[model samples]
Target: MLTMPDVRAPRLLCVEVHEGRPLSFLTETAAAHLAALAARSVFVPTTTRTRKQYRRIHLPGPPAPYAICANGGHLLVDGESDRDWQGAVARRLAEQCAPLAEVLAHLERTAHPDWTRKLRTAEELFAYVVTERALVPELWLKELSDWAGQRGWSLSAQGSKVYLVPRPLTKSAAVAEVVRRAGTEVVLTAGDSLLDADLLLAGDHGWRPGHGELADQGWTAPQVTALGERGVLAGELILAELLRRV
Candidate 1:
């Protein structure tokens, strides 16, 4: 497995599977910086992970007032999805892009047993499939991306999963709402995936790790800083940069 260097820095436990069972770790430097940033800024978590998965990782700070989950298919406030926002997102997805059922049908038609493990619909807004990354066919992913684009959807092949998400169902939309609610003018974000493009773009400032879908595509924007470190170290670098900038 590819792993980043465990640099000699004070470390903070970020995720744990069970009592005394560590799952993820971050540098204490990054943790303290993030905690200070949270105290002064509107700190919101934006991710492609489902709410359940997002909840598993703990950060050093007060609870975020808002979280964008399921690749922006759902917005969580105080750990729960805001029903009104969810309804609005569903309506927009229905009105603006191919239905979830249609996308699922397309996936079914193009299914390849060599890579696919399981297909799942999330929040009835987007779909993704667990795949053997080494077995994934590049041409197949390209085809899916082209097809989804034609239908106002997008395909993101990241890690062990391939996500098919509607164009309107975006993290930016939910984050914008959070900004409005908080009345904050400054927004900063850090992410490493193609699914995070919108969220990163929408923010006043953002950072992307030197790995994941965005880095693989060589994506960049004027306000976004691209770091060279990859893997877990890339994550730490992002937090460090976030602290430095804000």
Candidate 2:
């Protein structure tokens, strides 16, 4: 989390419970700003988290009507999977990307146990592993990216997690669907990770904090502003920025 001894951001009191314990927070100022934005505009959270994981976050606002979860593998409407959207996404992946099973098999064959800790598949749309980032070899990641690319997939390492996702499954595509449904002409977005690059690109304007994979890679587009804040402080600044624009 970003820490500044001289500057204090508002605290987000416990707003969500996970495994019977409190989790997920944003600044009090961010919470208020988001509430105001939600009241007037379409506010959709596009994330790489699975549906169950995403549900753990209780942002300060009315329940969002739409959310893109599983990095765009699933679309939730009123907290329930929209079957039509799911079907469309599945079809797109089937037509354009290699099967998740193929990628998972390759991972099982090539991954070294020394660094790989936990392997997971999200909605069978993508695969990822939690590994010791320092222990993971640079050449290995490059090789994996090259191998996946040929198979119509992409690999991204964010902190301790390395994701192998299908080329067709993306947050931007899901966000576009939400915009079409909402009939909105303007969009503002913020994120800090590589998974969010497509989303940031899809937005009219976007912000990225100075941490996460996108920051490490010096990633940006014409409409995206890269900020210097990191961690929780970055979240605060991103929300504050979004509020200012919306």
Number of the top-ranking candidate, with lDDT as the measure: 2
RMSD of each: 2.4, 1.8
Segments in model 1 whose C-alpha atoms lie over 4 Å from true places: 1-12, 16-22
Against the reference, the lDDT scores of all candidates come to: 0.82, 0.87
- The collision pairs in model 1 are none
Alpha carbon lDDT at 101, candidate 2 = 92
Backbone Cα, N, C clashes tallied per candidate: 0, 0
Top TM-score hit: 2
lDDT of 1 by residue, 106-157 (tens): 8887878777899898767789999998988889898899999999998888
How well does each candidate superpose onto the true structure, as a TM-score?
A: 0.90, 0.94
For candidate 2, give the lDDT. 0.87
